[model samples]
Target: MQATQPLVGKETAFITGGASGIGRATVLRLAEDGFRVVVIDRNALQVEALVAELVQAGYDAVGHAVDVCDRSKISALIDAEARVDVMVCAAGIGPSCAFDAISDEDFRAVLEVNVLGVFIASQEAVRRMKPGGRVVTVSSRAALGGGGFAHYVASKAAVVGLTRAMAMDLRQRRIAVNSIAPGFTDTGMTRAMTPAQHAAASALEPAGRPAEPHEIANAIAFLASPRTSFITGQTIFVDGGKSLGGLGL
Candidate 1:
């Protein structure tokens, strides 16, 4: 592990999977909170576009093309800056396949990116964080369990577990580790559903609509904020009551 650097001027926030979806939304939200964000994604084109967009908005930002599951790539990234104030572990991929039909390779790929990827990112990022540093990870409401997405759900559950463990380990360092479990979010991933399927799926939620990326971003922003120091190892459900299942809360 590398020696962590002290945070300097213009607090820096780095986000994995930041080129699109929830991660992209997090980048913009943190930038608004005055972070010079570094967006990481394997999609070079999307990363470039996001960087350009941020610059156009007069925010300090940059892009890195990297895979979160690649330890070597991530090791190189852990030293990206002198100090990292916040790291959003948002890189994940969840593919759907029937339980019986799910290939070992396919399941492994999902876990690699969704589970191991978060672990690697958090491990490196936390090692590089200063005291009061923050890590906001993206889990899923499905971690509570659902049908048809065993691999993804299991991976997300792993994330929640990892979050608590990380919080305990980093407690002495004053680093907050937390996660957000989003449900029925409107994104490219949801867009893959047929229009009717999408609508019907969202209707199942008490909110009666899928969450916009920015809505979930709001949760990430709050968790990553310096003000959230007292809140650690908690999974904030941004899933619009879907986690409740008819239990009035």
Candidate 2:
């Protein structure tokens, strides 16, 4: 581990699903670290609020409301000449049932958000990124196995596959791609879990607690930073040692 420094200031980062959760935390972290952030989210109001907050803090940031699952919209978003230097594919969904219990519609929706969404965003970003650009996608420890939540797990496993594949394709271009698999974290995404369920999950972690959104954000920031240019095709686990705690969530 090295002391991290702000990358080239003129560089820009386009973050997807950046209105809340780990995405928003990454946006704030990147902006504060002296990178211009371009935030995209489905919630226009929340995106606006984030932009306003960043601007008030004297950070260079902007917000755009676009569905990452839509290819055309994603293409248009990255069509600018800004030439983004970093992309954080934090846009995803996990509120799904078990494989047999999930409806066709629900299963497709999960893949759309977790798998296809990352592909589209990465494709669009790659087209506009400089040679040394960085890309980091949010995955989950659930992807390691198919337990009760099959749909979510499968989708996230796809993310890890995509990360490795993209790294191979972009190696010649010097564009690094990686994924972060976080365990249970305290965020809007986990807010829906029953208190008892949350407690059970927390107890499973060797740390005896869940992680904060900022904790995950810090991992992502490291991957996106220029200091990590040599660290590609790796799935860095930020699960408070949970991945080593028997790999169950």
Question: What's the lDDT for all of these models?
Answer: 0.87, 0.86
Off by over 4 Å in 2: 1-9, 246-249
> Which run of 10 residues does model 1 get worst, by summed lDDT?
1-10
Best by lDDT: 1
TM-score of each: 0.94, 0.93
Best by TM-score: 1
lDDT of 2 by residue, 37-109 (tens): 8888999989988888887788877787889988897787666425578989999888846567888888889
What pairs collide in candidate 2? none
lDDT of 1: 0.87
Worst 10 residues of 2 by lDDT: 1-10
Model 1 C-alpha lDDT per residue in residues 12-71, reported as the tens digit of each score: 888999999999999999989988788889999898888888887878887889999888
